[model samples]
Target: MSQPGPGSNHAPPAARTSPESGPPFSEAGGIPVDAATPVTTFSPVVLEVPGRPVDLRMKVSAPATGDNLPVILFSHGHGPSNFVSSLHGYGPVVDFWAAHGFVVIQPTHLDAMMLGLREADDPDAPAYARSRVEDMRHVLDHLDQVEAAVPGLAGRLDRSRIAAVGHSMGGHTVGVLAGQSTADPADGSDLDLSDDRVKAAVLLAAPGHGEDLAPAVAEHYPALKATAFHGMTTPALVVVGDKDWNAHFSQRRDWHCDAYSRSPGPKSLLTLFGAEHGLGGISSYDAKETTDENPERVAALRALVWAYLRSALYPGDRAWADATAALAAMATPVGAVESK
Candidate 1:
């Protein structure tokens, strides 16, 4: 059903200098660089979300040959780039995930600049904060239709094993899906938006509680003022860049670590050494908004995320552990990985 989106409810640490430590994949974590399978992507797989501002349109990317593929519900961030915040963006992340495994689904949220739907006085302006989550729920609810729209993509999906991955504002959406709740800024009502269908998640450069938000930011997105992590009990891997600081959001660089530091057990943290908000142009191949442009950093980040999702969806997989070791073995590690 329809609900609040981003700007709806709200929401790292580190260890690496560089990940040039070793080869791409060791015995433990990563996959072979050249081993990625071919992928097929279907766009504009439109679906109906009742009460939504517009019809839900998505881009589905999956392996050309695979069975029992796990699913990833990728949510884009509210970046400054016009198209990077929509389904067409995050090519670096989406292509990589779809190449290795997992069926990637990216939705064009109502606030996406690509949609050009926002207005000066629009109630959903500033980003549909709450409605973003609604979009994910709607996507999961209509997987049958989504599969049918994509040729040879049915039955290959493992509906029971689903994970959520989000960056920036999108990470806030994952937080809510993983059980984060907060008090409404307008009223004292509790906002519980977590979804049981999401078994694991990744929160990248996400914000902390609204109470500690920059005075200017909190004024507009008040629902995040007290977004608590005690309720984020889902298994997740939280990724944060050491140098990802934005004065418009918060003055504290460590504010991004709350998703890992404040949350319960079964959570891990990845700290990328010299990265910024874009995390090496994950939004686009050459995203203008990417302050730190390093292809190696992007490769490492994508590999680690893939490994995390692999082991998370499969109980006996060694992808996460192996990838962690491979990263740590780098002569110049990308960052550090730790779990509680």
Candidate 2:
């Protein structure tokens, strides 16, 4: 089952739904919404991949009524595309930056790649890895076209200021885009360094950190390999929940301490104190259990993430002063114990 390429006939999803547009995750039960901005969404145009029929999902947003602005591309973790865009659809983050003044695009890669078609008949087969990267490339190209059509989007997108954000498998895509390898095992052989379009990356709860990918992943794509995040030239901010299954692994440790230390530009690691692997934003976490145990910890986790995103995206912007202050203002919850 081949997918529609970069300029196919698929229609983009309707924009401006709710504040929680990225992934559906609640910290302490109830419902979660963005505390930062008004949810004004923009429509996306469906395009086909050049040489293939894949349909890539992309939404563009600039300041509601401003000129050009920095562009950020958001890629969701691996799984169904719906899983990524359900509630906190990355749209909220895009909307946040747009509200503060920036153009953002979040692409639906996994959905377009796999389309729920199992290739090897094995439920766990790695059917969409190849298609995933291709879709990423296609999305970038599509965005270029989009910028061209909308004159206002042209110069506004600071090519050198572009950044990529990812979680789980999407983080691996960012690593690949950053020139980190996914083939040579000990070396970064599978890296796609040709683009040079991305300026920075934010990898959240990356599943691509282990020595070898998980068994299900390994079985699906035996050629899959990855190396240390050593050669990244641009600044980066790696965020991980301390309780992530691999939080204590050597790869995770090296990525933070060594990778950040050796990188040419500035870099930092932020470990969310009590958040689980999926963080507090995805559905997989047991929010009921967490809330029953501790509530302040949950709020702290969200605040830390929002602050990191603010400072990283806008660097020296004065408006982010509040976010920076919030970062420092964070304190340990009354009864929660901090862990390394």
For candidate 1, the 10 contiguous residues with the lowest summed lDDT are 2-11
Instruction: Please give the range of 10 consecutive residues that has the lowest summed lDDT in model 2.
Output: 4-13
User: Model 1 compared with the native: what TM-score?
Assistant: 0.89
**lDDT of candidates 1 onward, in order:** 0.80, 0.48
Model 1 accuracy (lDDT, Cα): 0.80
TM-score of each: 0.89, 0.66
What is candidate 1's CA lDDT for residue 208?
81
Residues 103-125, model 1: lDDT tens digits = 99999988788676654355445
* Candidate whose lDDT is highest: 1
Model 2, range 1-340, lDDT digits (tens) per residue? 3322111112232233345546544332221223333334544546766644345656666664555455666666543343443223544344545665556676665433234543434322333444555556666766667676553566556554667766655665565676554453223246444247776676665544334344543434443434445566555666655544432222343332333444445666666655544454432233221212223444444344444444655677443244434444446321121112
- Could you tell me the C-alpha RMSD of candidate 2 in Å? 9.3
